[model samples]
Target: MYSRKKGFISRSSRISCTTNEVTGRYSSGHSEDNSNETSNRYLSFRGFFRTAHGSSKLFLGCQNFSSLVGTKSGIEIDSDLDDGFSELEGPTVTGGMLETNVETELVEDDVDGEDVEMPHDKLELSDSESDARKAQVPEELLKAITTAPVQSLDKVMVNWVEKGNDLTRADITIIMFYLRKRHMYWRALQFSEWLELKKQLIFTERDYASHVDLIAKVHSVQKAESYIEKLPKSFRSEAVYRSLLGHCTSKGYTKKAEEIFNKMRDLGFPVTSFACGHLLTLYKQTDKKKIADVLLLMEKENIQQTEFTYRICIDAKGQSNDIAGMEQIFETMKADGMEPKMITKSNMAKHYIFAGLVEKAENVLKQMEGEMHLACRYLLPHYAALKKADDVRRIWQLCEPNARIVECMAAIEAFGNLHKIEEAEAVFDKMSKEGKNITSKHYYPLLRIYASHNMLAKGKDLVKRMSERGCAVGPLACDGLIRLYIKAGEVEKADSILQKAAERRFVKPKVVSYLAMMEEYSKRGDVHNSEKIFYQMRQAGYVRRIRQFRLLIQAYINAKAPCYGIAERMKADDVFPNRTLANMLSKSDPFRKTEASELLLYC
Candidate 1:
């Protein structure tokens, strides 16, 4: 380090100095130098400032020497910072400001995109060009997605093909297959136009069998036969043959099913367990004994015994009310290393239910809980039939939280249809406490439970809670409120509720709620109120159900009016007699000829 007084830096810079200029830069680091006199080739500040015999005055640049500000400090040289090029050759170091030259070159290097080779501070959050890439999906596939009626897909696909667009049969198959699988069965036919173009390619037995399976799954038995008859010989794979017989068995098509199974056997696919299973179901349903013998013979052939075969056996035992035989099958399954899975337990539950052994059936259901889905299939109906709401709740409690939601919701529906609203609410409360998700199915049942039990206050509280929890309170809940008000004999209140729901843009009222209001009016024997609500129902797009017609018919019969055209229409529309209709007919003495005729065909 070197220092000079701040006011005299220029004067110090003018001090004469001489030394080997190269020594200031590279000479100090010189391990090798080419010179004859080695000591003469080096110079130091001691020799340079010892004496100056030349006119050349050497000074540190003004800016470089400017910071020497002290009278108490002596000028001292301490070497630290060095750029290797500082004194390499014969070039004048004296020029413009020294630090400015270095900054100029640094800026130039930065603009020219060259590395300055200086130690630099690291940068934070530095970004580059590579972050902008996006995912790409094929344009053709995107264009195929349409919200229009599916009938349009077939035409679009045809145009694509005719226009030499690179779409394939596989693409068309995927779209239609998904459509049917998603329960868009009616819409799936629209894709048949596109499918027709690929008929020749897709008409193989395997493809036809797959289509038969699709039809069976969709519950389109009538369509299944029509399509099966139209299929070519190449399209009747083993599965197709089995599906045709399977359909027959399900619909109790014994002769047709047996015929198809026999034909399958003739075609050398006789070893099929599915065909055998259908035969067993046929015999079981009709009380034919030959099914077991035939099934046993096929089993001995060392062919794979499927779960469906055991299912048939279980069904047969249940249908015959053969409890011992069913137990025998359960033992056989265990001995054969087949654990009692949900399907096995479900069969037992079904058998027990038919036998009126509710406790035993419940034990079986609980034992198989979560081991399979559809365990609720047997239990939901059993509880509904027995009016056992607590039984339904117990079964759901034994299920996983997710499975419980699905099962309990189903139970709620079954109970609601039976008008056991209290039972449905009890199950729903359990579901809510169990921390299962609430869905739309749970909504109406919960609302009706509140209404039927005269707990509309609680019901309104539930609706508010649902909104707070971000759950959807659809129109069904509002409709339920309307019925509750009517059933509680607050007709004006019910009307107000309906108006509020409509103004707030709740979904449309369900048909049952409308019918209930109309029925309430009919119970008052008030024709005017019933007709007004009935017309409103029509304007609201509700079709008159059989029950609705019966309600109105009962009111007319109670009036005992002679047949005008209106009364004739009401009589014809009556699906079944209500209490008023029955009472009216009963009042007419048995000797009344018209009343006697009416009683015979009343329902």
Candidate 2:
């Protein structure tokens, strides 16, 4: 079992407290009021500050923690970080707690033949110094981790520690938060695993939840579940289960998510808005009919509705074309003392645009003024839907001077939707000329425009330019390129490009890309290539959905080829066909003619 040290709070609380202290210090130029609070808080070190002769190597070539703490009185080390210091066996100093003290240790200086004072493994820091150091720690760690190559993260962290930097729980909390905010889940998971292996900080439920969430994102939900099972029982709280549930919901595994939800209830954990919100979101996508039941249950449980909860409800109502109902929910949300967030308003406006209620959308956009960087993306598309080219142009102009990347992409889409291909091209050209840090995603809208308009030559040119400019030709680009080739009747070229991309270990084609190829091959009665793509998809570890199987069977029927073991194949893949697929299966059956003849004779 892992150590259950009580001195450490959950990661969230630590971050909140640290943020308050740092904000206070920077705002007032002093954190005198927070000094006592800082002294009482504990900080953990990972055995990188030992002063014993021939002891463990020092971090980053620093002789002691004095440089990090600034002065001897800046920090005070205590022995209460871990209970009994049980892991500090032999000459290795495992971990220590930092609290408040003015006492300093003195040592004889051999060179000067005089006594000198050295800090006692500085843990807690004084007001101004500690707050500044606290703010700086995350910056240094983020720079080190993000700048290094993925394979070198562990070595880089080790080098950082060896440089005599303090590795506290608070630093890890802030770093992980930033890593996740930037969507660097793989690197975040790697950092978490490294921390655990090095026994840096004691793991809490919050840490386990974050780890499980990252594993689900970077690896698989199955792997996440396995990791959860191995977690110490005390750490398997609602947050961990809900993390798994949220991912399952995202993947639309309704049954699995419901099972997790039931497990949460069986464990006697109170169902919060977070758990119900996932359920509502899942049902909103898969089974909108079940949304009412979830909301009713939330009301029955007396759970206070949060912004997310109301947003999902509003979306459900809007999607059902219940404009009045959606407004009512919005009013109820306000009555519950919750103001609508930007995303909530954006979602409502999106539904309004879809419903042809442009005036309502305009009103929502009006409320969102001063946040033009955000609201402009919404406005461009809403105006595009109405074919208001002038309005689209006006909004696109508003995005100038400091337009975000997303707004630029939205403008391209809005222009494309209005069939203003030249305008879209002009926007793209401007982005390129301005050197606006375009990524592969910026290419997608224009590529899609060319594909939809059957401008195969233009699509090919853009893709070539992308390659020449060192932009990544990822799966989405490959998908659009494949569509262009198919539209131009160059099926062979499409297949060749997809195969090359798949052959490269770094680029995995999207499921839609594979499906598009399979569908074209099926239409041509090319059962062999269809089946090849099918198995390649499986080998690539893409989830084998029923749609792929449907396309494969269509290829067999179109070819008049008698497919063998199709039922067994589907069963092995745990994908049973529905009525339409079953009909197709009978048509492709090897013995179907004989069976029909036998039935005729019996009749």
For residues 1-603, write the lDDT of model 1, one tens digit per residue.
011221111113222222333233222322222222222212110111211233211111110000101111000011111222122111222222221111111010010111111111111001231121222333464345433333466566566668876654455455544443333333344454345556624444544664664565344556776787787766656767676666555444444555666566567775556556666555454323334334434534455545656655555555556565566556655655666656567667767877898888767766655554556645665666566767666665555355656576677766775677666677677777775445333465666666777776776666555444433333455556676677677787776555443332202444555566777777777677677777765554333133455556555555554313443444553323334544554443234457557889867
Q: After superposing candidate 2, which stretches have Cα over 4 Å from the reference?
A: 1-151, 166-175, 317-331, 334-337, 352-373, 433-437, 464-469, 500-508, 522-525, 531-603
> Which residue pairs show collisions in model 2?
59-162, 59-163, 59-164, 60-162, 60-163
Off by over 4 Å in 1: 1-151, 159-177, 189-193, 198-204, 212-233, 286-290, 293-304, 356-359, 362-366, 369-405, 413-603
Tell me, by lDDT, which candidate is best.
2
Worst 10 residues of 1 by lDDT: 64-73
Model 2 agreement with the true structure over 92-178: per-residue lDDT tens digits: 222221111001110111101111121121111222333433454477678778656548889999998999999987787667755
Task: Tell how far residue 410 is off in model 1, in angstroms.
Answer: 3.1
